[model samples]
Structures are given as structure tokens and as C-alpha cells.
Target: MRVLVTGGAGFIGANFVHQTVRERPDVHVTVLDALTYAGDEASLSDVASAITFVRGDITDSPLVDRLVGEADVVIHFAAESHNDNSLSDPWPFVHTNVVGTFTLLEAVRRHGVRYHHISTDEVYGDLELDDPAKFTDQTPYNPSSPYSSTKASSDLLVRAWVRSFGVQGTISNCSNNYGPYQHVEKFIPRQITNLIDGVRPKLYGTGQNVRDWIHVEDHNTAVWAIVERGQIGRTYLIGADGEVDNKSVVETLLELMGQPADAYDLVSDRPGHDMRYAIDASTLRSELGWTPQYGSFRDGLAATIDWYRANEGWWRPRKDATEAKYATMGR
Candidate 1:
């Protein structure tokens, strides 16, 4: 099948691009990205020759329509992701996450194409530390942050289109993802990069916030499963059953790097920080018979750390770009 992967140049998206091409040689994939600071083309450089890369924003209805019309399936992954960045300003999140999803939904509806949405579990808000609150397909959304609120809105739009217009589609909300090719602004990679630079690893809040972590590769696999085998007009929760407190994650990194636990710095948490997040992925497993291949968080963390250690050049430039932006504002 010919598929269009929106925002496929970004971290998880780029990994999806590579994995898709490798797994299904017969499927042709097209990636549409705005090439934002977060959407670096270099991440997909290795597979650049194989996949169709279109540097465009998802809000462009005409572009999205054209691409959707030519493909059998569209995987919508484009969005302004990052809670810290979202809180500083929310307009971009609305423009990309909300309006962009609307644009893609309209395009896919007109084209009569099947679509899949890649969403985050943050939409369910925080679970009480002592009480379990794993978000399932039936969970009601209670997004607290700008990033999640906008994502929740986007998800609503997708559901509306499916029910009202009979658009063939499925949505998969996944837990926190960590792996190689990720931008350094994210929690795991940022902490890893800082540790490697001999700087204190910054932990948001008490670092007690809990999140169900899944490797990006496994998340991509789940997405493909939804696209290929999932039921139409349904939402699936994709998780690795790997849950950990933020402090524990940092401590694990320290142990892996042979650093002292005191090497961490407890910083002010981002506004509206969720206390915990987990996902009930039984729907995907029972329906699609999909299981996570990466079950051990320790193994995943070790492999991811090694990847960053071995590929400094990739992340160094990204960090430099963010630092440059800060410099520009200061000047």
C-alpha cells in the first residue's frame, strides 16, 4: 500500500519511516514535514534515497489533500510536541496539532482514504501515585497541559470525522517513548546528553512523576499494526507495560553511566506537570495480537544510551541549534 506519513522527518516519525521501508518493501511511503527545528532531515538521511520526503506543513490543505489522494493510508504524526515549549506559548500547538489534524481529516475524507493517528497518553492526565489510573481506549480525556489539551482536541476531531463522515480511521495513544534519533530537548535524551557533557542531569519536580515508557521502535511497530490490521474507527492504547518513576529513570541512567546519584538536579517542574501516566494496551493485544518486543526498560535504556554515545554528531548539532536560539533571544 502507498502511505503518507505526516511529520515523518521528526524523531519517532523518522524512525517510523525507516522501519516501514525495511519491513514492507512493497509499500511506498511519503513523508510530509514542515522541517521545523525539531523536524531535522538528517535523522532520515540514511533512508533519504528510499522514501519520498515532502517538506511541507500539514496545515496546508491542498498539499495534504494531494498526498492523501495518492495514498491508500495516511498516518498523521505531525504536531507541536513538547510540554515545556507548549507552556511557554500555545499558539503553535493549536495551529499544528488542532488545525493540522482538521486539515488532514478533511483531506482524507475527501479522498476517501484510510488513516491512523499517532497520539500520546498524556491526554488522560495524571494518575494518583497510590491509585492506579492506566488510560485505556475507553478512558475519558482530562488533559492538563497545553500540549496535551491540543492533542486531546485533535483526537476529538479525528473521532468526529470518523463518526460523522464515515472516514475510515484508527487512533493509537502511546505512553512515553525513548530511543535513538530523538531530539535532546526531551526528558530522557536531554538528561543523557547533559550527563555526557559532565553537567548535572536536570529532573523536573521531585522526579516522582511516573510514566509508562516504550521504546520508539516498538511504538512504530504498534502503529503499523493499527494501520494494517486494526479495526476501523477505534482507538488503541500501545504500551510496553514498563512503568517507572522519573527519579528511578534518572537513577538508572546514573548507574549505567557510573555516575553518582547526587549528579542530578531537582529543578522546578513544568507548569501542569502530570503526576503519573500508564496505558492499558489489552485492546491492541487481544484484537491485533501485537506484543511489545522490548519488555525490559533497563535493556532499552542501555541500548538507547549507547546509541547517543556512539552518535554524538547527530545530537550535538541539534543541541547547538537550540542554544543558538537562546543566544538570539538574549541578544
Candidate 2:
């Protein structure tokens, strides 16, 4: 099988590439990436010789059409994903997320290629901290950030293409992901790298916001399962039941790094910060027989911390600038 992956150099996408190359020798993989600030070719260094890499934007229709035509399947993982950055500038998010998905849909529709879209739980908005409810496949869309709103719009575009144009595709909305090659700007990596630099971690607001954390490996595994066995036009939520609060996450990182639990600062929160996000991945589990290998959040976090510590060269270059950007927002 020949697979074309969009945004394949970014965090989760890069991890997906690595996983596919290592496990599926029968498959030939081609990566299409824009190489933006968040997309680093260095992330794919270990697998540089194994796959074809194309530097281009997903919004380019001719390029997208040519790439999508050559592939047996296309996995769409490209997006302007950071909520904080989207608040500052939403146009990039709309262009890349909304318009890019439309471009891909048109290409896939024309060529009759199978496509898989990666999305987030943020599209379902937030649940109260105490609510037992989790985001399900039937959850209503109520995005709170420009990032998520664009993602939601893109998701709707995919559904429309599938129904109106008979495009063969599936969508998976996952929760927070953490693992190697993740940008230092993200929450887990930010706190881990800060502690590595002997700096205190910063928490937004009172640090009560909650998220369902999943290891990147687990998330990618679920994506592959959906591509192979999932029903077309169906949406699946991918998670490991790893729901954790921001405060506890910071405290845990501090403890893991041999610092006091309270050795962190509370910063001004971003606007429209969701109170909590949880995913009900029952469909991915029971329907497709998918399961996460990382059963413990702390164990997964420990592994992620070790990855950043061991590969300082990969993340260190971006650390200072990322922290500076956060400082401006009081995050």
C-alpha cells in the first residue's frame, strides 16, 4: 500500500510516520508537509531514508491533487493546532484547517482515494470538571477557540464530502497527546523542558482545567486501526482514559523532576479556556478491537520526560523562543 500523509513532519504526524515505517514494511509512505514553525523535518531524521518527503502546503490544489492521486490512502493530520496561537491570529488556522481540508476533500473525491482525518476533542467543547460525561461520537460541536472552531469546520467539510460527494473517508477526534518530537510549546513538553532548564513550570489560571491525555504512540495506533477496519464516514474518539487536571499534571512533573510539588507559578489563563475535556473511546475499542499499550499516565509521562531529557538537542533550539512567546501571554 502507498500512503500519503499530510503534515507528516509535525508532532503527532511525525510520530505516525515513524510508527508506520517501523511496523509496516509492506507500505510505502510519502509525507507532504509545509515545514512551518511547528513542522520540523528534523523530527523525521531517524526515518529520513525510509520515506518520501515533499515540502508543500496542503492548500495548494494542484500539488494536493497530484499527491492524493498517487496514494492508496491519505491520512490528513495537518492543522494550525495550538489554541493560544489561534487566539492571536485566526486567519492561519482558517486557511490551513478549513481551506486545506476542503482542498484535500476535492482531490480525494476526484481520485476515489481513501482518506482519514485526524481531529481533537476540543470540537465538542468542555465538560464540567465533576461531570461523568465524556465526549462521544454523537457529541454536539461547540468549539471554544479559533483553533478548535476551524478544526470543527474542517470536520464538517469532511462529513459533507463523504455524504454529498461519496468520498471514502473516516475521522478520529483524539484527546491531548504527549510523546517524543512534540514541540516544547505544548503543555506536557513545556513543563518538562522548563524543569530541565531549572525553571519553574507555569500553570494557567488556577490550574483546574482538565484534559484526557494519551501517548502519541497510542493515538497513532488507533488511527491505523481505524484506517484498516473502521466504517467509512464514521467518527471515532481516541483516548486512553488518561484524564488529568492541569494542576496535578504540573505537580506530577515537578515530583518526577525531583522538585517540590508546589514549585510552579500560576499565570493568566487564555480566553475561553475550557474547564475540562474527556473522551469516550468505546467505539474505537469495542468496534475495532483497539487498545492502548500505555495503561498508566505517570508511566507514560515518565517515558516522555526521559525522551526530552535524552534528546535535548532536538528540542533545546526551540525552547527559548517558545518560552519567550509564552511569557508575553503570561502563560
Each model's total of backbone clashes: 0, 0
**Residue 301 of model 1, lDDT score:** 98
Q: Can you write out model 2's per-residue Cα lDDT over 1-331, one digit (the tens) per residue?
A: 9999999999999999999999999999999999999999999999999999999999999999999999999999999999989999999999999999999999999999999999999999999988999999999999999999999999999999999999998999999999999999999999999999999999999999999999999999999999999999999999999999999999999999999999999988889999999999998999999999998999999999999999999999999999898877767
Q: Pick the candidate with the highest TM-score.
A: 2
- The number of the candidate with the highest lDDT is 2
* lDDT of every model, 2 decimals: 0.89, 0.96
**How close is every model to the real structure, measured as TM-score?**
0.96, 0.99
**Model 1 lDDT tens row, 242-292:** 989999999999989999876797767667888889889998998899998
Local error of candidate 2 at residue 199 (angstroms): 0.1
Clashes of 2: 0
Segments in model 1 whose C-alpha atoms lie over 4 Å from true places: 321-331
